[model samples]
Target chain A: MIEKIFVGSKKYWFWVFSLMALVGIGLCFYLEQFQYGLGITGMSRDVSWGLYIGQFTFFVGVAASAVMVVLPYYLHNHKAFGRITILGEFLAIASVVVCLLFILVDLGQPARFLNIILYPSPNSVMFWDMIALNGYLFLNLLIGWTNLSAEYKGLSHPAWLKPFIYISIPWAISIHTVTAFIYAGLPGRHFWLTAIMAARFLASAFSSGPALLVLLALIMRRFSKFDPGKEAIFGLSKIITYAMIANVFFLGLELFTCFYSGIPAHCHSFEYLYGGGRLTMIMWLSALLACLSLILLINPKTRNNTGWLTLSCCSVFASLWIEKGFGLVVGGFIPNPLGKITEYWPSLPEVFIALGVWAIGLLILTGLYKIAAEVKSQESNAA
Target chain B: MNRRDFLKIAGVGMVSTIFEPVLPYEIKPSKKRLALLIDITKPFDIKACLDACNKAHNIPEIEDPKHKIKWIWPERFSDVFSEQIDMPKEITIPVLCNHCENPPCVRVCPTKATFKRKDGIVMMDYHRCIGCRFCMAACPYGARSFNWIDPKPFIKGSNPKFPTRTKGVVEKCNFCAERLDKRESPACVEPSNGSLIFGYLSEMKDLISNRYCLRRKPDLGTSPSVYYLI
Candidate 1:
């Protein structure tokens, strides 16, 4: 099974090498960031977290979305998802890798990261988040590898693997919930101190995760002998549609709560995001893209068509990436605790480090996917 | 016993032993809760207090406002009390860490790097901090500052007695715990011309009892130790 990744087409090797090259460039910039300090990044005392944290938040959602497929396929016995489940699990492994790397890059003292485990404070949401994310990563790796190995051997997956698969469903939900608690549990930062934050995170995660999965499945169809089945893709699009709708509705709820109540502390962050602040343009663009994607997804005619579906999926992924990834994290810090607005923009080194992390994730995804595709193709040829 | 069961029992025992010390100990009610009261009504040299704090802590003089490390500074009355519409805009108030009794920073630190002492003062262990900035995000008051770069180059003259922070750790006013340990008043308090009052909350009751002192965002329930005498 491991050998399958080594044997790939020239194009596959090119893709692998390109991602590696990006990882190399990113590593060089990261070294510079290490030598200097987090000062090299655009973050200030007012806005302490920036691109690194935002990316970490976004990828946590991506990683948790694996449960969307796992739940339906395993518990509900949705056979259509069986072919795509491995893809979801593999994507989760890659996304969690990215999430952990983002956290590492964002840390002021990367070497002291072990302190979180050494001097564990269960009172902190960060402590629980560390447990949830690492546990999920481990679960995905164990379950994914065991199942894939069994498949490659043309044997039924072990009976013992059943309990682990079931546990993964709730564990997936926990990862995103704990991540949301990191923000929602904070005393200040009105933008994040909402009870509904976890719900909103799950909604966006479900939408963005499935949207990316659909795009990857389409890419696999075009580039490889393995076909993930049209029914599986259709099922995922339907999930994306409902999740995006929920995500938009949750955003609307936040708007109504902030504006209708008319509290300055509560409304200032939204005012900065949608009104005259620096993020105004980007925020509006995300909203526009969300609406556009919804319009395309809601209609069955466009939803079924590959071209329109691809366009809508791209819109969904981009919209949530901006809304949840960039806007949400930065918006929380805009009106600093003292009613002062301090804007944040990532420096060049920060951007490269983030890009490098993404490349590492994609490289991992490429290798894992390459192995799964080979197994699926071999099974098909045998049949 | 089976190997699995034995392993589980061993794990539980080890975990309990590790966490036994971490469990909350009884805090003596008689222990002093140190507090500070800033009398805005009195005329104090704000610049002198700020200078004293910087020199005492060996805080860097970074030119970039974004990366500036400050333990204490003066802020406009209007900006600090934005909720108070009737407040005078021209008046400047000295602001620093409130040393909240129920510190959100202590709650959010993953490694227990920032913790609330039994005496109701929040403390930071610089060596243990992972620099996640969770404490900065959690704090209601913009008091905490991270060492964004190597501060040694920016310090005009280093204070040998005090530890100058390296880059990548969050730091803030320790309520001059070091000075308190030496039985000396805080650097800022000494130069504040009696404007900044420092004492136990119980002992300072006479000063705050008669005056209408306000705590920053008192409604948030952090129970800030710093009070403002208007």
Candidate 2:
């Protein structure tokens, strides 16, 4: 089993080494954070949640977006996803792992996390979120491993696996939907307190998630044996376009409602994001980049260019992060009940800790993909 | 549905239906009642509330270094402003645990830690609260306060008698549950004497109507135990 993972030209050793180094740095940074307290991070009374929670919110969506591929490839029989669907399931597992870790880091007492379960609030969306994340993690792991193992033996999967894949499709959507509920359920938080929130989350998740997967597919082709065909890429690209269009459309509706209704509660958060206030620059930059990403993806020409495609994928991801992580979470607190804008910035230790967690997630993704690549290579060689 | 059936179907619970806040809590003209009176027109004296609370509910008095918010009001509109006036010709709405017949907090509490009293006051078992803040988020009145830090000693050495809450959990006013049990009035109203009224909410609602004139978020249907002398 160990030899299978090390099937050596020793190329992967470099990735493993680099990951190890990052792990060491991450540990040092996290230790400093623990010594001080969350105060080590930029978060304060106003921005109680910083990059860790923000990134957690963003990545959970990415994890959920795997449903796009999972649903269509397996249940709907979209032939375009035939060769690459397992990639999406594995990606879901990796992304959920990251999402869970980010939440762990954000907690004031990571150890007390089980208390959430012990003292679970079923009515609270958080309880449901925990349920979804754990459920999705188990479901995807089982499905990905079972299906891939079947692929290795070159045999059909048993009938039972089919239903699990179908269940995962909706479960993926639920994970992010429940995440959006974490925000939407807040009463006075203007930006998050929208009925449109869940729809907007799905829109963004569907778009950015598949876009990231597209880039991953591109990387695999460039670096290894798993070359997902253009038809598959194009199908995913179309799905991405549809979701992006919806995401942008939902954002537009938010703009119109906040402006037209002219309610301060609704408009203030928008203003905070778009330049009516301190976060204007970030809001503008995020909006511009995100908008441009969609525009680029929309056009058949630029969307097809690998370089441009990668750039746009990053732009969309960053834009969504700015919207959810920064504006949505922090803006809600400004003009706190006293309506004061107490600013927030994550400390260096916080940043490092966050980076460490991201590095760990990436390492997990890298390891899993390496094993998959090897297995695929062996299968093809046998054939 | 029967209690047994509801719990079984819900597949989860806080079994104590001890005091379900529905509405029209027992109209006994004689039973002692509890509530808080707020002049919502001005910045609420969260500090005053903390200062007044000697050892509210047996929970240790946490001296908020930042005085981290015990209460606040957005002060929405003209009617709200008018409603808060001293109203020698005006109002003073008592608050603290609406102990509503339909208390939103009790409905939403994940852990059955918060429940309505036989007296119809919403109460929390501090011991059971894990501080998830979901109850805080669910509460519409902004009545909840998270234990963002250790409970500060009210005095330099007062036996540190209040509950010391760890960070990450939430807390709020409990109508001085400890005081009520000891056969005393809530500390806030002790100063009000007759200026603040406590009794069966039904009778008190009538008193506010006949005497000072009463009103609340009538539309919300919370059936708040609190009533204002408008």
Candidate 3:
């Protein structure tokens, strides 16, 4: 089976090489960033994190939310998700790698990261976040590989892997919740200070995570023989619907609490996210796209339509990305405590560093999936 | 439940109870407990505080204007609680480090460089820091400042009274530890014209009780050191 993978046609090779080239381009950009500090990016004294940290914050939820689909399918005795669960796990791996790399790029002293492990502070939410993320990453890798190998070998997986898989389900939720505490625990940053932040993070991550899986499932079907089937896509989309509506509801709840009472601290982050103030452009764009995507996604007819579903997912992904990634952290700092509006925009070099980190994720994903495909092919040939 | 099970449970319960007793007074320790000054009423000026601190510490002109090592800027207290707010809370309190019992900045620090002193002052050992600035992110006060460009030359030209910071390290109000070692008050503490109060924890509380309106960010739980006369 693995033999067929190496014996594959030129197109497979083309995709592989294209990924490498993009990675190369991203590396060149990373070098420039290293030569200069974050000043090269759009980050200002007020806004410390630009695209790098924003993307990191947003995608970590995507990575951690993988457990949502994995839990019921693997642990609760649902075999229906057998086909796509592998894909979702792999996506989790890809997202986790990207999240770590983004954190690396965002650090003022990337090399000093060993200090995080050596000097762990139990009281800090960030310490828990690091533990959870690294634990989840290895947990998925160990189990996903063993299970896939067992499938290829036509044997029952080792029982030990089952416990880790079960643990990962709840562990995934822990990763994102801990990340939210990194913000909510802060005293002055109004946008992230809300008690509802962790709940909101989970709600949004579930929807967007499943939405991303749905989009990938469709792409897999079109581009290759790997059609994960309509059942898988539909099942994932249903999950998306439930989670999306919950996300929107939580969002509404956040707005109502902030606006009706009109506490100025609570109001500012929303204002920056919605339609007014310095970040209005990003806020309005995200809101518009999110609303439009919800319209398409809510209708079962349109939701199931492959083209519209993909479009809707991408829109929602971008919208949520903008809201959490681009807008939240920067907006939280605007006018600052000094009542001064300090603006930040990402520079080209920083974008390149981000692009590079994302490329690395894609390359890793492609390689892992490629190996899976090869091994699966060999097993079928043997049969 | 049997006696053995009850004993096990009782032992565990006793252990947990011994760890943390939030009870009002379960034998308050005898160590000289230090507290930060939190003044809620009156305007704050950096200069008067610096001068008084200089006189008290016997380290006059400790801050070199050329180095500009310390900064004291007026901030809207309203913004402290809400980001969307553009105005102050009408009555602004002079603010500084709350010297949090469980400081978040210390938690997120990748390098373990930033630490809170036993006396309720958040201080930094710059030598140990690798300039990661993650502590800056962990700080909710927007209190920590980083030296983006090299600060060595800038500080060198000043009074040479204070050493300049290097590029990449995070720095903030030290609560004048140098002065504390000399048995003097912080530069920020000396200039208070009854508007600000600097004293031990119990004394400050007595002062706060006597004030017209004494309040703090009830939600933060950090219990600040600087006190105001409002």
Candidate 4:
């Protein structure tokens, strides 16, 4: 099965090498950051977390979103999703890898990364988050590989794998929930102290994760013999439609709560995000894209059209990426506890490091998907 | 490889595990809950106190505001007390670690690198810190600062006795715990000329009982050890 990835077309090798080049460049910048300290990044005393943390938060959602397809296929026995579930699990592996790397690059003392496990503090939310993330990654790898290998061998998956599959269902929810607790539990950050933060994270994740999957499935159809199935693609678009609506509705609820209460501390962050602050443009653009995508997705006529469906999926993915990846994490720090506004913009090294991480994820996805496609093609040819 | 050898090792391990908790270790219970009282009404020399803290802690003098590390500094009154509706006369107020009883930083630290000591001071183990910056986010008062760069070059004159921090660790004031252990006054308190008072909270109650004192964001339930006499 592993040999399938190595024996690829010329185009595949070119793509693989391109990603390797990016990983190499990112490693060079990371070494510089390691020597100098986190000062190479745009983070300041006020906004201590910047691009790395924001990316970590966003990718956690992508990793957790694998549950959507897994639940329908395994629990409900939805036959259409059987072909696509492997793709979700594979995407999760790639996303979780990206997430862990972002955390590593963001650390000031990357060498001491083991200290979190060495002297574990159960009282801390971060301790639980570390456990949840690593556990989810292991679960996905075990479940995805076992199922894929069994399918390739033309045998039924082992019955013993049932419990792990069920456990992964709830475990996926826990990963995103713990990630939300990291920000939601804080006392002074008015913007992130909302009770609905976990719900918001789940909604955005459900929408965005599958939206990216739809794009990936379409890409696979173009380049490989694996057609993740038309029914499965449409099923995912339906999930994205409702989830994006819920995400937008949650944003509205936050707005009403902040303005109706008329509390300055509660209102200040919104003001920073929507009211003439540095993030105002980006925030508005995200809102616009969300609305645009929702309009396109809700209409059955447009959704049935592959071109419009692709457009809306791209919109959903981009909108949520900006809102969660850029706005939510950074907005929480604005108007710091002292009522001082210090904006953060990622440095060149920081952007390249992030891109490098994304490239690594893509490379992993390419290999895993290549194997999946080869097995599917072989099975179809025999049939 | 033999049964006797395995039995010997198991017995020793079992004995050590059983007795380790009961060992007669020197556990020093703190006799005082220390507090700092600042008399805002008095003319305070902010620069002198800042200078003393910088020299005492071996803090660097980095020109870049983004990467600057500070243990103690002065903030404007309006900014510090932004929740106040009526605008008071603007003045400089010294701010540092509150050493809160219910410290959010300690609760959020994954590695227990930042912890509250027995004497009500929040201590940071620089060596143990993974430089995650989670403490910086959890601290409501902006009390924590991260070593964004190697601080050695920026130190005008490094204090040999105090350890200079490496890049990527979080640090803040420990209420001069080292000085307290030596029975000497904090470097900042000594030069404050009665403007800053450092003593056990119980002993200083009489001094603050009659005056109108305030603690930063008391509503947050952090129970700050620092008090300002307005």
Candidate 5:
């Protein structure tokens, strides 16, 4: 079954080699970062976290999106999702790997990384995040591999996996929640010091995570014999629509609270993000696209059209990426602790490092998806 | 199951309970705990104190201020207190670690590397720090600094008494815990001519009782041990 990945078309080989090239390039820069210290990056004392942590946050969301498919299929017994459930699990495994790698590169002392586990401060949100992320990664690997092996042998999934499958649902929510707590519990950063932060994180995860999955499904249908099925895709779109609306609403609530109360610390970060130069344009553009996507997705006529569905999902993914990935971490640092503002822009090496991590994730996704697609194709041909 | 073994087990349990380390911040200051009081109303040269601290701690003289490792540094009062608009003469207040009763840095540190000592000094164990910089973000006073580059090259005439910090570790003024152990005042305080008071806050309560002293960002409920007398 594993040999199917090795036996592929020239186009498939091209994609695999391209991702490998990116991973190789990224590894070189990461080795340089390891040698020279994090000083090579654009991060200063003022902006301690830069592109690496931001990417970590984004990928955590991608990992959590797997539950969107898993819950409906396993809990509610939605049969359409049975075809694509493995895809969601495999996507999760890849995203979690990316999340862990981003953290690895971002560390100032990568060698001492295990101290977080060695002397685990249970009180720290980061400790809990480590547990949640590692747990989720293992759960997905176990479930994904076990189920795929069963499929290969033409047998039912083991009965024991059911308990673990049920546990994965809340474990998904816990991972994103712990990630949000990393920012929310901080004292000085007013932008992140909100109770709604976790709620906002989960909402955005639901929308952006599932939206990416939807886009991947569309691409799969075009390129392979495997389809996630119309019912499954439409079901996912409905989930994404509600979650995006909730995410937007949560952001509005944050804005209203910060402005209405007019606390200087709380209001300043928003001013820096939305009331200032290029950042303002980025924020407004994300808002506009989010609204446009929601409208497109909500209308049955537009949503039924493959063109609109793809466009809408892409828009939602982009909008949230800008809002959460690009803006959120950077905004929290502006109007820094002492009311001094220092801007941050990622260096070229940092960008490559991030791109490299993304390529690695896509490589894993491609390998996993190829195996699953091959198995499905074999079943269809036999039938 | 034997009586001697049962007694030994009970004794070990009781002794362990008695000796288990408690967080210093949680325990009320029964013994005299040290604190620093800085009088900013009078003009004083800050350069001398900054230099003394740099030399004492083996802090690097990074040419770029952006990457400089600051233990104790001067900050404009106007910037520190953004909401206040009163015409109290322009001033520079020396800011360092607050060694808070409820330190957000100590709380957020996953390895317990940054912790408050029994005498109320917030200290860092560099060997244990993974350099996640959660402490930097957690600190409201902008007190902590990270070793972004190798500090050894820039350190001019390294102090033999104090070990230099390596790259990829968070560091700050440990209230001169090493100096305190030697019965010497902090390097910065040694030069402040009587403007800087270093003593147990409980013992110095009579001295600073009526003075108009305030800690930075006191509203955050961190209960800073360092105070500024304006």
Candidate 6:
């Protein structure tokens, strides 16, 4: 199946080469970081985690979004999703891979990475996150592989896959919930201490993850024999619309509480993010894009048109990328624990390393999608 | 004859070595749980105390305040305890790790690298830390400092007793755990000349009871052992 990925159009090879080029550049930067310690990056004592951990948080949501496909198909028996569930599972695998790579690159002592496993502390949220993420990865691999191979073999999915599928539904929710707990459980961080944190994480993950998946489906329709069905795209749009709405509602709730309480600590991060700080432009842009996306998606007439739907999905993804990936982590540390302000911007090496991780994820996603497309094409031709 | 003679020599050597007993390494526990009492009410010279801590800990004198590492230093009373009422102006309160009974850093550390000792002193095992800096975020006091760059080059006249931290690991005031092992008071305590009290909390209860003492954000429930006498 993987061999078929190699026999592709020149554009496929070019894409592969471009990702390879990025990986090469990233490796060079990573080597420099390794030699000089984490000093090469833009992080300081004030803002301990910068771009890498922020990306780690974002992709955890992306990895967890496979639930949108999994729940409807497995639980509700939505036949429309049967064709594209494999794409969601593969996206999860790629996103989880990127999430893990982000963590690895962010580690100051990469050599001692195994200490997390060797001396596991049940008390730390990071410990549980490690378990949830790796467990989700394993479940996806097993479920996706067995089901796909069964389809390729032209047989019904094995009965044993039933329990695994059921387990994965909750497993997907747990991964992002635990990731949220990683920040939310800390006492000093006013920005992440909210009770609705896990809820917001899930809502944003569902919107962002599926938006990317939908865009990928549109891309697949253009390049491959797989149509992913008109109904399947519409089904996913409905999920994105509701989740994005819930996500925005959650943001509003946070703002109302922070401002109404008049507590300086509670209001500080929000003010820094939107009140003429470094992230002000990105935060406002995210708000504008999300509002635009919501307006487009909520209207049934606009959503029906594939062109409008595609644009809406892209907007939601970009909006969440700014909200979660760029501002969320950095904002939490602003007016740091001691009431001192320190700003952070990624260095060139940091940017390269992050790009490299994304390129690696995309490369894996491309390969996996290639195999899935090949199998789908064969099944259609045989029919 | 040659084989018998070698065998006899080897057997005697083994017997002789077995009779030579090895000496036991004694591990004595330090005096009862230690605490620090900073008497902010007194007019103590803070510079000497800060110098003593810097000298004792081998802390680097990095000129850039952003990257500078502090083990113990003077902070303004208004800056740290803004909520306090009737506190005197122009008084400097020394700030260091609270070494809390319930340490947030110890709880969040994934590798158990930062741990609280039996005597209620929070200690860091540098070798075990993966440099995640999660502990830094968990600490409410802003007590911890990370070596953002190699801390060695900036350090002047390094102390051989205390090991200089490498870049990436977190370090803070250990309450001079090494000094305690040798049955000496913390470096800052000695320099303060009765202004800073270092003793078992049980032993110093009378002194603390007489003073209007406060710990930073006692409501947060970290149960910090370091108390400031106002």
lDDT of 2 by residue, A1-383 (tens): 22455654566677777877887787898776554445456655444566777788888888898888877877788988976787787788888888888777766555566755666556556667889999999998888888778877787667899889888988988998898888787644566778899999899889878888888888988888867888888788888888988998998998899999997657766666565676778878888987899789889998887788788878887787787666766676654433456566566777777777878877777777776777777777887
Q: What digit string (tens of lDDT, one per residue) describes model 6 on residues B1-230?
A: 69999999999889877643221111233346789998876778889988988988889887756567888877777667754565545667889999887787887888878877778888988788888888887887888887777788888887899988887788899999999899988888887878898889989999989988888877677888999887
| lDDT agreement with native, every candidate | 0.92, 0.67, 0.68, 0.90, 0.88, 0.88
DockQ for all models, in order?
0.66, 0.20, 0.21, 0.49, 0.63, 0.27
The per-prediction tally of clashing pairs is 0, 27, 21, 0, 0, 0
Q: How close is candidate 2 to the true structure, as a TM-score?
A: 0.82
**Candidate 5 wrong stretches, greater than 4 Å:** B1-31
lDDT of 5 by residue, A86-128 (tens): 9899999999999999998888888999998778777688888
Write candidate 4's Cα lDDT for A57-161 as tens digits: 999999999999999999899999999999999999999999999999999999999998888777788889999999999999999899889989987689999
- Tens digits of per-residue lDDT for model 4 on B1-230? 89999999999999999766333211343557789999989997989999999998999999988888888899998888777534467799899999887888988898888887777888999999999989888899999999999999989877787899999999999888888889988889989999999998989988889898888888888889999888
* Higher-ranked by lDDT: 2 or 6: 6
- The per-prediction CA RMSD against the true structure, in angstroms, equals 3.3, 5.7, 5.9, 4.2, 2.3, 8.1
What stretches of model 4 exceed 4 Å from their correct place? B1-31, B85-87
Single out the weakest 10-residue window by summed lDDT for candidate 1 chain B: B21-30
Candidate 4 is scored at a TM of: 0.95
True contacts kept of 4: 0.80
Highest DockQ against the true fold, candidate: 1
What is candidate 1's lDDT per residue for A1-383, written digit by digit as tens? 99988887899889999999999999999999898999999899999999999999999999999998999999899999999999999999999999999999999999999999888788888889999999999999999999999989998789999999988999999999999999998887789999999999999999999999999999999999999999999999999999999999999999899889998889999999999788899889999999999999999999999999999999999999999999999999989988888888889999999999999999999889989999999898998
Model 3 Cα lDDT, one tens digit per residue, A1-383: 33444555688789767878878888887666565544456765456556887788788888877787787788676676876787878889999999988888776556677766666555556667788889888987887788788887788689888788888888888888888887787776777778988888898898888888888777766665565778778777777777777888888887888899898767866665555575788778887887878888789999888888888889878888888888877777764544556666777777777878888988777766666655554555676
In candidate 6, which residue ranges exceed 4 Å CA deviation? Answer: B1-32, B86-90
Candidate 4 clashes: the total is: 0
On lDDT, the leading prediction is: 1
Report lDDT (Cα) of residue A142, candidate 4: 95
Q: Name the runs in model 1 displaced over 4 angstroms.
A: B1-17, B24-30
- TM-score for every candidate vs. truth? 0.96, 0.82, 0.82, 0.95, 0.96, 0.93
